[model samples]
Target: MARVSQEHLDARRRQILDGAAVCFARNGFHATSMQDVLKEVDLSAGAVYRYFSGKDALIAAIVGEVLDQVHEGFEEGARSTPPPPPDALLASVLSRVLATKESVTVDGRPAFPRLIVQVWTETLRNDELAAVLREGYGVVQRTWARIVEAYQDAGMMRPDVTPDHVARTMMASAMGFLAQQALFGPAPVEVLRDGLRGLMSVPDRGAGSQSG
Candidate 1:
């Protein structure tokens, strides 16, 4: 048999992943099956199985792609002349995420955002997925911590708090944005950026100031 070129193999893998994404986004994880994926891609069972063993594996691959992209954004930000502020960095991250072709379903609904809600719920019962999620987030957290340190070095952020603490809080906010996007249709990324700015801009009341 003639050997398949690497480019051909890569394209096939992309086809499977993209088709599975549409299926999962439309019907959800539990509702989507390997057979459903095969029908969506119009590929033979053997061909599709060559890439993903089952729906669990497909779901894991999709989630991994999303996390990997988020991680890459932080890596890029770290190398800039000055790293983006937490809010702006997150807004950029979300913009890239929402702009991906795979992020939208055929019906014009957000794909990854909906899948993310399912992934979070799946973590409770899927140990492998839970571990994958924890590992992915840990790497992202470390990347953000380095940015936090840079901010501290420039006196842009307070030195009193640990970098991990700030990183965790920022990540929590990003996750919250995804949750909201998943549940409530798309909102402008600026809303999140501006809201964070508003929170950070609040004037601090001096201890001496009090009601008479």
Candidate 2:
């Protein structure tokens, strides 16, 4: 009985988050009222409040869910047995980012990316949301930096540069592309891959040596 109740509770939370995502994606976060979210969920006021304290709480939960999905994809890529070569790892990461499963929709339009943009917009307005965004981005930054370090250690990435530099460049590029795609639905993933291939390429350490 207790276990069943727990399962039902978890499902209800996800339902609320899903409803909130749809609402925020449509109206933008600051403009979206709790009443709007309630309308989206079609649930009793008390029931919804039980899961989230208020609008901020619900938005925080939605942000948490998005960051979790991003982290999961990173973990899945980082799991290649024997570890993937640098190019392979970067390729797989880009492939995973462009995965269609990330797109949730309302009324046939993609909502997830829009929701993320809305969340970012709110982060500047709400201190709590800013903290949450910072924490989540910190996790992502460290994860990518570790992967970059690994590539550098293997001599599969350029030397003379810190892992932070490589990680920041790749992360910034990927995120910028996401923001662009969210607003404009720009070019395919191949364009990004092609662009990054040279930036991430392994430098020949012995290129300047006199080999006679």
Candidate 3:
């Protein structure tokens, strides 16, 4: 028998991960069984183990994939604009997230929100998972902080605010809103936009303050 190429192995791993995501989205992390994932991929139990040692590993991969996609989306959004202001750059990042929420689904459900919730819960119980989550969140915070510092340099943000503080606050606000929307229904984007504008201290093209 010939050894499988790295490309082939990666493709197979991705296929398994996709199927695992569907199962996880539908039945959740703890409730989902390896058998369910195997059935989704139409693979034997042994085949599943060849790629992922167990459910915990698979869950980590799923969460890692989601974070990677988000990072890619933000990078693409930032690159699409040549040299926008910090506020505009941050808005571009937010737009990509909103677009992702609209486009990506698993098991006929929005994956990011459910995935985030599941990962947050898992992080509480699993140290390895928590470290992965912390790294992803650190990337997010640092990215936002850099953008905020740029905005401050451009004189777009108030002098009193620190970039790190603003970045943390922005992340907290976005996550909080997403949690609310997931618990209830779709949140009004305009409301979120207005709140963000206020938080970022985006200068008005016209003369006055806008009410939220």
Query: Which segments of model 2 are wrong by more than 4 Å?
Result: 1-4, 76-103, 186-191, 198-212
lDDT of 2 by residue, 1-212 (tens): 44658889997887888888888888887788999988988998999999899988888888887677666666665554334654455556656644633455766766766777788788777999899889887887777777766666677565767877766776677777668867886456666776677655657678679586
Among the numbered candidates, top lDDT falls to: 1
Candidate 3 backbone collisions, by pair: none
Q: Could you arrange the candidates by lDDT from highest to lowest?
A: 1, 2, 3
How well is each residue in 1-212 modelled by candidate 3, as lDDT tens digits? 99989999897887898788767756778899999889989989888899899889998887776677656655553443233554455455556666755534664556566656666777788999999988987887777666666656667566667878977876676677667655665656566776666755754465445555
**Backbone clashes in model 1, listed as residue pairs:** none
* Better by TM-score, candidate 2 or 1: 1
For all candidates in order, the CA lDDT equals 0.86, 0.73, 0.70
Task: State the lDDT at 134 in candidate 3.
Answer: 86
Q: On a 0 to 1 TM-score scale, where does candidate 2 land against the true structure?
A: 0.80
lDDT tens per residue, model 1, 1-212: 99999999998988998898888767777888888899998999999989889988888898899899999999998877568888899899878877885444757876777778888988998999999999999999999999989888888787877999988998998899889988888788899999998887877676348666
lDDT for residue 94 in candidate 1, whole number 0-100: 75
C-alpha positional error of residue 121 in candidate 3 after TM-score superposition, expressed in Å: 1.5
The 10-residue segment of model 1 with minimum total lDDT is 101-110
Model 3, residue 32: displacement in angstroms?
A: 1.4
For candidate 3, the C-alpha RMSD (Å) to the true structure equals 5.1
> Where is model 3 more than 4 Å wrong at Cα?
1-10, 72-91, 94-107, 186-191, 198-212
Per-candidate TM-score against the hidden true structure: 0.89, 0.80, 0.73
